[model samples]
Target chain A: MALPITSKKAIREWKLYIFVLPSLLMVGTFAYFPAASAAYYSFFEWAGGDAKQLIGIENFRRAFSDQVLLDSFATVSVLIVFNLFKMIPSILLAVLIHRLRSDRWQYVYRVLLVVPMIVPGLVTLFIWKFFLDPNLGVLNGVLEFTGAKSVLVSLDHFFGWGVFFANVPIGWLSQPQLILPSLFLWGFPWIGAVGVLIFLAGLQSIGQDVYEAAELDGVGPFKKFLYIELPLILTQVRLSLVLLVIGTVGGYGLQLQLLNEYGGPDGRGMVPGLWMYNRAFYAGEFGYACAIGMILFVFILALTFVNNRYVRIDK
Target chain B: MSACPVSAASPAPRSNARRDWAKHAIILFFILIELFPLYMMFQVSFKDTTTFIRQPWLPTNPLNWHWENWTFALRLILPYIANTVLVAVTGTVCSLVFAIFGAYFFARYRMPFSRILWAAFLVLMLMPSVVNITPLFILLKSLKLVNTLWALIFVGIAAGQVFTIFVLRNFLEDLPRDLFEAAEMDGASHLQQVVNIVIPMSGSIIGTLGILAFLNMWNDFLLPLIVLRDKELFTLGVGLIYLDGEYVKQWGQIMAAYFVASIPLIVLFLFTMRLFVRGLSVGAIKG
Candidate 1:
């Protein structure tokens, strides 16, 4: 043992690798190994077997031409549109809550907002699925009770003249045309609790002196928001934007539920991630799925990077 | 920064009483919107079939107090809950252990390849979960680990370590290093220091990370759905889906099932809400 004398420092540092190894191993197997394996598998064709044929970018070629992929892109654009729609309410609510007179009320609202997080997200979607049920939905009931349905019917009759659209008892999730807007309605008034709280944090962090300075200038609320508050909380907006991009693009929750094993009428509800999932496990096109995964990864990564560079609210 | 930084605190001036009322009203409206879906779920669970169908938005017959829905929902999902508990507990423990060790070293030590490795992990953390799903499914199948609670637990542990490690590393870095150095000067071994000093001070974060991990595993749907096919083997997430499959769009029953699945997390949230909110806000701000 004395023959090879290692310094205590060397031993101290070397032992650190032991601590590092378990994490690396876990992450390697699940995160890196799969990522690497996905990249590797994208080059080969396999259907749940050892025998893999070299496809040589055939999957990528097909993916571009695939009708499902094209349709998904279209649907994703719609999703993106609604996503932007969703952010406005979220930001407005954040502002509203942040302006509360009482800290106790603010605390109550904060807790109330986050209480929903305890419910599984998928379960929430399922609950909304019920709410979107054409026949027995509360929304339709509310429309009936409040006579909004009749108002809508008359408005549709006046506006459309039976040319393009009409008021109908719509199956929000099931209808091909209504899918996008219906999905929006399902998570309607989407005051994202996390978004609100994060914006509240950003709002709270704004220097009081900045506000006082703005007040001294006698700026109206709208002008103040446009000039001062907007600039200040732009960082939160950016963060929320990035998060939305990730959640919408990467998240399979909505598509997986609303579509419920298959894409909606005429594949209207299909998004890219769900399409990738279906291709992978259900279709057994491992190579194709991996290619899809890689494409999604690169797309999101590029989008995020571009946003960070060009669309930044804060440096 | 003294307490209440003058008129700058609230959004509107005190003199603008009308504006204050408007702001309060808007806040209430948004809160109602946020809570509406959840309210629908809870109120529906109490409604009888007819009442649920007719007056979902209205109050239920309070005297009736549909105990059957709770009983049915709880009974159906009890095994699933038990399975979830096993997975969540096992996964959370393993994740916390691995993260603690990794974070301690990453926080305290100056090691070769640390920067590169840390960067690699950071990049990996950012990579979307779906990107890894296909290959991971294959990997799991090949390892003959699919459809087991252990497999679910394994995946949870593996997936959760990234966040747990990131959070714990940041937390540990913020703590003063003097105590550890003192222990080292007293001829304390790394293990001894970790056991005595690190563990003693890390109760809150450990709790925070543990709850977060447990919540993640508990609420996970896609992974369990893909992995487990056997109804008995399924976790709550997958089980609830199968329940939904049986009763498509049955609001009361569906709501009941959801409430049952949600109870554990609700109780957990109740106890650890401060830590949970702080973790979320801090994570967002810092990231």
Candidate 2:
């Protein structure tokens, strides 16, 4: 029912154009301009300052042969896989909350689920960094107190893993071998509060009649989940998957903060985004950084496309 | 409240109650595990370094609470917190204002090329900002805005536009058109119509969007890190990172700083918990 502004009566009301002008101007100047500039500068030999030259495909060519960049992508791929597994806890918690018989309890549980999120994500990252400190961390303290350290030592002896030794604190973030494990250990329980609520929102739309019908068919709890709950929430699951992929690929905050810009030890913690950051800021290779960014964009775009095309189920 | 019909209709109320307890127990177990880290943070915030080292697991004794840690952290991070509030509030308000106007334009009229304009915004949503950071820094520097809080505010407003407009346009479209029509009949200008009709009608949604945008700006680190070069301009995220990088690690003071950085958000979330959750779910469903 939108009235076309080209209509005779609406044409005179040209002032209506004023509504969108601010948005267009702001986005054009900040968002679009920078993006267009990135594409342009990717082909240059600029060092992020005044000096520049037309490098023509040279930056992209170097990116193609860049082992460090490729290895960073590999590290991200492993993290993405771990994140995919981490989604299970959130889904299970959502299903549990959705199945609660009392609405009051459901609200209480939901509020409690959101409580931990009040702390900004940056704060949580730092707290985890504190916990992962080898000598003075709660993680090592708990391991030693619970005798898990001794078990890990024996296993290290059996497996000849030099990372874990007796009477020595395991350098979780510092050691090359344990970098990925430390990253995975972050945000333990990983019951992403927002993720659970999204899945719960999806679950709430399921009618009571559906549950009754399933019960009549003698569908047990596990079978009910397989047949009904999971299917109903597949849309939300797909959405989370797409976002997780995008975030994991582009996110470098954790690595930049927890590990050094050099990516610690054998560069095991290096992610593509961090590599781009290091290139531009540390190495003064703005052109190469832009190329890396383009590579990340294409990679994320393709992953999102595949997710939408394959994992989709209309609810 | 969809207790299985079989269980509800049957005569086994006691076991049903027992099963409810089991469910609650399972939920509480997960909740406790999730809350452990936060609990540890709060407990350790009140302990000095020596106390933390000696009794890492136990709670700080009431007689020996290190109030100095809190005071020291506040003295150090208070300026950062103030800067964040100024930037987040101004940025969120400006972004929401612009978004409301733009969403109204998109929702109310279909002009020539309006669809194309809307499509441009949609494309912006999919375009990653990673590539743009270096150029954005250059852009801001060219405008002589870098290293100032204005840079963060402007970029925050710009980065927030697409999502806000997208969500608001949907909400505005679903609004009862008759209200706007009546406002037009009353000889209200479009701006007046927005102030009288749209703002009142969509207060909750606007509030939700505002909180979400504010949260994003508050926790933002990357843009501020790249743009700002001065310690005086550091937001909480960057400020905390610098604090952490100091050679002599004071765990107590550092944890206290984390708590200080989070207090404002915690206070805000306490009051707007429902709206915040609703906003997130709306975003999830619509994004």
Candidate 3:
């Protein structure tokens, strides 16, 4: 039974395909093709050469066992933890802002919170770095004024504030232990800018009737949040989690800036993104870097899929 | 359920006072925490090394106001800003053009493989930028597009298309089908219909998409870092990093530079917050 196909229908279909062709070509050449090449490169030990030796799975094997890789994994895990800690509070703040009755006040807060997001990453990084500067930095000065020893030990030598406060400086950036936390402090406020915006959207979508019902039942604000608001906005929470996870794992560009591309103080703050970057560019370990990138891609894909499924189920 | 009497509905006066105090304290605490860092940045930007060290917490005495750092950082960063603007604006314009036409087709015609094409666009939207970095870098290098602003503009346009198309397609799909059918009945060509109808109706969506795309392109660091070898081609993100590395010890100047770089974005965000928020919510929630 041959299906009757009209010439008009066939021409219309062909025209549509023609319209989509340019976009497909662009995506294939720039995105899909490169993605496939990255996967292929992951399997062999080819370091920028016309001829390559085949080392099947050797690159992946080395990537798994490498100490630097392991360290980066641990660092990324810690970063994710800190990011959640920061992001949750920011979301709560956004919800609070949305709860305010005055639209004028809400706009003011939105503008202030959003300022950080617009700030160039370079500027934000430098401002925070200055704030934490051990010597002549404002943070140390505040600590000294509060009857505490200077946080920056180097400052004691330069300022000569007193012998009692002449201990080694906080060494915020130079110290490996402080590097991760310092980076978190520098980056956390910016998270609020985006988090508030997302949360504000979520809050608005929630039906006011739910809140009114809770109130009629003599429910407190906290109980209403737990029983209604929280459940309704779970989709936004999941989206945010997925975003934070990807950003944490795949975001090494900022670290390279703040930490001078060495992951700051013995590579304590080295993330997977930076690890892949250093491997490919600095060490010319193209195969290994691609393997790491593929692994990250798979992880992100799996997480996003899981998040989407979870959201669907909740709905 | 037991209902309380109307006379007993209100809380005790003492309890009300306590609740009011608690609310006020909590709000004040959070406001201070949020504003303090920004305040510190502003204060430090004006202070010299000695005074900043002597009283970091106190308001600047005599306000040294290092206006010179502004000029210095501007001298260092202006080229980068110009480059960023060029790439972001051009990329956004190209993306909008492709997305508008593509979305119009998807919404109007029930073409063969339409479902599959839509699904492909969605999947591409989920594909993270990190996954494409290495191959794209090599591809650009092979094309001899490295160190040029065009490399960034092209990539940005390509990368932004999927989401823009998705947003535009959704808006277009919600339009009345009869409107398009009537245009077709009047013998209007597809291009003419798009020009006469879709473009006019899509003003808000297009404007929103343009703003979002521009912001993303402006803030982007990784693509420029890889493709731009010449310092002059550096975007704001890369330029700031270069400046930071060069003057590692000059914390004041670095912060000052950051302050200057952030102002334009802040202004844009402040003025367009309502539109930005509305667009973000629509795109995010609908997806």
Give the candidate number with the greatest DockQ.
Answer: 2
True contacts kept of 1: 0.52
How many residue pairs clash in each candidate at the backbone level? 0, 0, 5
Per-residue lDDT over A84-157 for candidate 3, one digit per residue giving the tens place of the 0 to 100 score: 78777766676666555445556666666655456665565566676677876555666677746644445656
**To one decimal, what is the Cα RMSD in angstroms of model 3 from the true structure?**
5.7
lDDT of each: 0.78, 0.87, 0.72
Task: Give the lowest summed-lDDT range of ten residues in model 3 chain B.
Answer: B1-10
Worst 10 residues of 2 chain A by lDDT: A1-10
Fnat of the models, one by one? Answer: 0.52, 0.59, 0.32
lDDT by residue for model 2 (A6-93), tens: 5775677678789999988899999999888888899999887788999899999999899999899899999999999999999998
Where model 2 places Cα greater than 4 Å from the true spot, the runs are A313-315, B1-17
Query: Between candidates 2 and 3, which one is better according to TM-score?
Result: 2
Q: Once model 1 is optimally superposed onto the true structure by TM-score, how far is the C-alpha of residue B60 displaced, in angstroms? A: 2.3
Candidate 1 deviation (Cα RMSD): 3.9
Q: Give the docking tier of candidate 3.
A: acceptable
DockQ for the candidates, in order: 0.49, 0.63, 0.31
lDDT of 1 by residue, A112-138 (tens): 888888888778877777777777876
Q: Which stretches of candidate 3 lie over 4 Å from their true place?
A: A1-7, A138-166, A188-191, A205-209, A309-315, B1-43, B47-51, B54-64, B282-287
lDDT of 1 at B10: 47
| Full ranking by DockQ | 2, 1, 3
Best by TM-score: 2
